[model samples]
Target: MIDTAASLSRFKRKTPRRVIWKRQGLAFLFLAPGLILFLLMIWYPTVQTVLFSFQNVGLTGSKGWVGLNNFDRMFGDPQFIIAWRNSIVFVLLSLIMGLAVPIVLALMINEMRRFASVFQLIVYLPALIPSAVGLLIWRLIYQPEQTGILNSMLKLVGLPPQLWLSDPNLAKPLIIVIMTWLSAGGSTLIYLSALREIPVEFLEAAELDGFSPFQRVWYVVLPLISSRIQIMLVLQIIIVAQVFTEPFILTQGGPASATMTPVLEIYNAAFVNSDFGLASAWSVSMLVVLSIFSVIYVWLRREDTGMN
Candidate 1:
């Protein structure tokens, strides 16, 4: 009897260990495919990019290892400076338009007691359009000639037609406008969702305390949605810093490299100039900038989780 009792206790303890091991095995089994895909798709390319940055790769293959020669060439290039400056300007413009406009739209949409879905659909419609198609449409609209859609509108308003994408000064800002028009809807939806999550009681309490609509929004609503604002700000900065497609399709870094951006520079180096090594170095530099923002994103996420 004593032996049986001791054996039963041992069995009970062993069963839980076996169950835990089984669960762990199953968890790993479920995670294996995703982990393998991540390694192949993300990690492998990242490693290759870093390695290629140090080598003089061409159409044939790598000429040989060139140490930091690719990086030296990239930094010394005048276009590189122009691209970096343009990227910074794009980021600032995106912050002004992309960040504030969405919040305002979201707030206005949130107050609608009717036709809210219609409003949402209208706002988000542009986002549903293919990026290439949208850029093409905007390209035509930004044509320098008087027959261009925007220029035609200016004519109707008795205003002078202006060169948009063709003008070095206007090209970058026009791109930003197109970007905001294309992107603001999704951001507006996100902000609206965040705004909805704010407890009704908080707003009611603020109202009872004699808060005006503006005061309530400024004091109560903004604070609650501030985290989302931070997240969107960082994301916009990262994205605008890598502005490529719009400039590629619209300006092609032309009109004195006014709308040139880092990613565009990278693309030009690799495909246009057939200098893969220099392209990879430029990519690595961009990666460093993006990684800093990525770290901030992760830290902000953790802080938000802790606060919750």
Candidate 2:
């Protein structure tokens, strides 16, 4: 009996299983198209960008490799320093003002019964406007030298006319406001969807228990949509950090480089100076910063869920 068992085990080990190969081969076939495109478009370019970050390659010819030289230049450049400062300030202010406003608007809209579609449309229509059109409209509104609507209003209210975009001090803050107005609609929609998914029975139960409107929202609604809030916070941070278009169109990073963001600096490096290597270095730095935030956001979210 022992010999027969050993012989059977040996035969099983030696036999070629067509089933295993067929299953694996089918899986590979299903995955091959997407995998090939990802390798070519994303992975390959990312590897090349990393390599370029370390080199001093020129447009016309190959230059000698200079490890970390571009990074050194980036640190020393006064413009780059200004860009870093502006990026931080812009993102901070936007997060404080723009980020929270959308949540509030979404909550209010969720509670509304009359003309819900109109309210949603009014909030979201700005997002659908072409960037160029929005830029032009805001440019007219923020026109300097008391020519804009805001300054005219100030004049009407018996106040001094203020420079909305021309002054370095006011330019960054004004940009933050514009960004908040234009960008918050998308977030509002996301929050609204989350709010809709919440069980109405739970809210009704809270109401039956003598919960006031504000109390119900505070304890029940907020807790239910906490995940959506977390996601929006991270996404807003990502978008605000990489802001370029508003600064470009509105301030041009000017009135003393008060609006120069990291992305703008990278654009100037690559296109204006035609320094692909240095641009790649700057790009890598921005990507690293974003990755750090992403990891922290994920870890914190997990911890928050675990505690809950």
Candidate 3:
């Protein structure tokens, strides 16, 4: 009887231990699919990109190992420099001027007591428009002739028919404007969500303290939503830096490569020039730059929070 009791106790303890191990095993099994997909899609490509950056690769074959020559070549190319400058300008414009509009618009929408859904729908409509269709519509409007929609409107106002996308001086800024218009709605939607998450008690307290509507928003709402705004700013910077389709379809990096961006340069290097190795090198550089930008944005945002 003593032996039976001891054996039963041991079995009970062992059973629970086995069950815990089984549960942990099942959890990892469930997670494996997602982990595998992430590694295959994200990690593998990154490793491949870094490797290809070093080799003297083309569409044909590996000519030889070119250590830093591809990067050196990039530095010497004036067009690459131009593209890099334009990319920086694009990132700055999108973050500062482009990002602010959405935040302001979202706040305005939140203040409305009626027709809120209508306002949201209208604000989001621009983002829903297909990119190709949007680009085509803007292309026609940006046409250099008086027959163009914008030039005709300018003529009505007694202003000169401007070469919106043709002139080197105006093309990049014009592209930036188009990007801002199309993308503002997405940012507004994000800010709207963040604004909604703010505690109503906070606003009420501000109101009772003799704070005006503007003051409440400026002091209370803005600070609370700052984190979301920072996240969106980083995302916008990354997207704008890699801007391709709009410029490729609309400008083709034309009028002396004025609106050319890094991604455009990468495409030209790989496909047009058939220098896949050099293209990969440029892509690697872009990745490094993007990673740095992301880190800085995160650090600055953390500092903002720490200050508050």
- Stretches off by above 4 angstroms in model 2 are 1-30, 297-308
lDDT of 2 by residue, 261-288 (tens): 8899888888889898888888888888
Report per-prediction Cα RMSD to one decimal. 2.5, 4.2, 3.5
What candidate 3 gets wrong by more than 4 Å, as runs, is: 1-25, 60-64, 296-308
What TM-score fits each model? 0.91, 0.85, 0.87
* Candidate 2 global CA lDDT score: 0.84
**Candidate structures ordered by TM-score, highest first:** 1, 3, 2
Candidate with better lDDT, 1 vs 3: 1
Model 2's number of clashes is: 0
- lDDT winner, 2 or 3: 3
Candidate 2 global Cα RMSD: 4.2
Clashing pairs in 1: none
Q: Kindly give the stretch of ten consecutive residues in candidate 1 with the minimal lDDT sum.
A: 299-308
Please tell me which predicted candidate would have the highest lDDT against the true structure. 1
Off by over 4 Å in 1: 1-23, 303-308
The alpha-carbon deviation from the true structure for residue 212 of candidate 1, after best TM-score superposition, in angstroms, is 1.2
Q: How many residue pairs clash in each candidate?
A: 0, 0, 0
How would you encode candidate 1's per-residue C-alpha lDDT over 18-92 as one tens digit per residue? 999999999999999999999999999899999999999999988889999998999899888888889899999
